[model samples]
Target: MSGADLSRLSLNTATVKHADLRTAVDAAASAGYGAVGLWRDRVQEVGAERAARIVAEAGLRVSSLCRGGFLTAADDAGVEAALDDNRRAIDEAATVGTRELVFVVGGLSGSSPGGPPGAATDRDLVATRSRVADRLAELAPFAEARGVRIALEPLHPVFAADRAVISTLAQALDLAAPFAPGAVGVVVDTYHVWWDPELRAGVARAGREGRLACYQVCDWILPLASDALLSRGHVGDGYVDFAAVTTWVADAGYRGDVEVEIFNETVWDAPVAATVATVAERWERHVAPHLAPSPGAGMRLLDAPGERP
Candidate 1:
């Protein structure tokens, strides 16, 4: 961005799901992206430290680790396993030099003793979410000790049945309230929260509470894909009013990484370079405008000495 000095955009590895970690980092850097978000699978492919090294060597920062939570489960063993996994994810985030670990808090508890994601018509969302809060409290100390914070991501409410029970910025903040803002906060992703009627209020509240850990940009498209998870699109390719939501985030005094996390097969199948290029271009056009030292001036969204968004 030396030419126009736009804000540095982060490429969530899932956006380029087809690429290996090394290749993804290379493509991101080559496309002039300054940061990246990593999933555990990709990190495990080359080991966590090495993955961190790969990104650092490429002169890129690891904005935030993709995830570390799924605390909703009907069985005690399954819950403990998720807790153990979260602890491991905390260690990985520390090694990767990112303080924020984005968590997709899980959905309905399964009817079987196995865990969630199975059909469970009798599940109780209230009880599941209550358990989510308890688990967050349990993990807060571990994350705080390692200097890693849990950034709860609010998936669309539709996903509340099978994905994350925390389905709104409002709900995430409530779960995060019991922990320190640094230990537990919320990820404001446009793709998920764009449709919320209380988006403005939620963004404002997140800002006021200093619970805005990350701001993810993506758009929603119709004609649902076979896998609904792949329904995200480039910023301008969908109906998301990025300017409005981004303004809400910026006005809330959030000075962190604005991660570009998408999950669409079309994007994944595209040439990685072009995908990164498209992400960069869209950030400049749709997102960057509402952020920075001054939105009107359109200064680059600076990542200087702040937590990764």
Candidate 2:
């Protein structure tokens, strides 16, 4: 990637999971990122209202909220509880001043850490996915009322049995079809959707339908971790062809912030300054060039304190 400006880049707080909201926002701003994607835990650290004040004081925008969707509960009571939690999450997103709320729809019924795959034990994949759709229908109006868009994120197929059941951008788009574009949308995350055979067409479909609410980038490194969820790498460190996927998103008319949401333990353990600088450098080199020039494309970017010259 080349020529793209830094005006459109955003730092996802999960990439620096150890930092508090204030520190993360400040680090992102100092690194010249235009926005920051917040996680619910970080926001609740000092309360959403104060968290919004911190981000606003840093002169950065809140790109999106980390999540709000575990709607795969089996019984009526469980379903209603999930809906209530999502409603609270939507309210938090509004308080934090962002329009996009990213949702990682839950896995199978009995899935648990260190347990058998839910698919092997439950075998009710169809029922679980249907629950997600039904829950979205229930939450859509509430999100719309607060000017928030529920951005459904499709995890890689590897996570279907434990983390998220929606495993392709096409599936997410299909799920978002019943609601107004402003109410429901889809997240195009490279780490998750990069391997889909239908990725190109799916991205185009998302753009055409105005469902492309968020675009995230990270590399799928090999030699998977024991947990598998921690396998993300910095841009250019893995095999993802950012130039190709970025071009598709740009061509699809998505001009929103491009977030760097890494899940690697190594990245999270690194110093906040070093991680932020590395994200800027890698994003500029591997993911920025293919992007459509954002407004204020030539805006000045401050060099983070230890950034390599």
Give the runs in model 2 whose Cα sits over 4 Å from its true position. Answer: 1-4, 117-121, 293-309
| Per-model lDDT | 0.83, 0.88
Best by lDDT: 2
Q: Which tens-of-lDDT digit does each residue in 19-120 have in candidate 2? A: 999889999888788999999999988999999999999999999999998788888997999999999999999999999999999888668743686554
Residue-pair clashes per prediction, in order, are 2, 1
State model 1's lDDT.
0.83
Check candidate 1 and list the clashing pairs: 214-309, 257-309
Q: Cα miss at 304, model 2 (Å)?
A: 42
lDDT of 2 at 200: 88
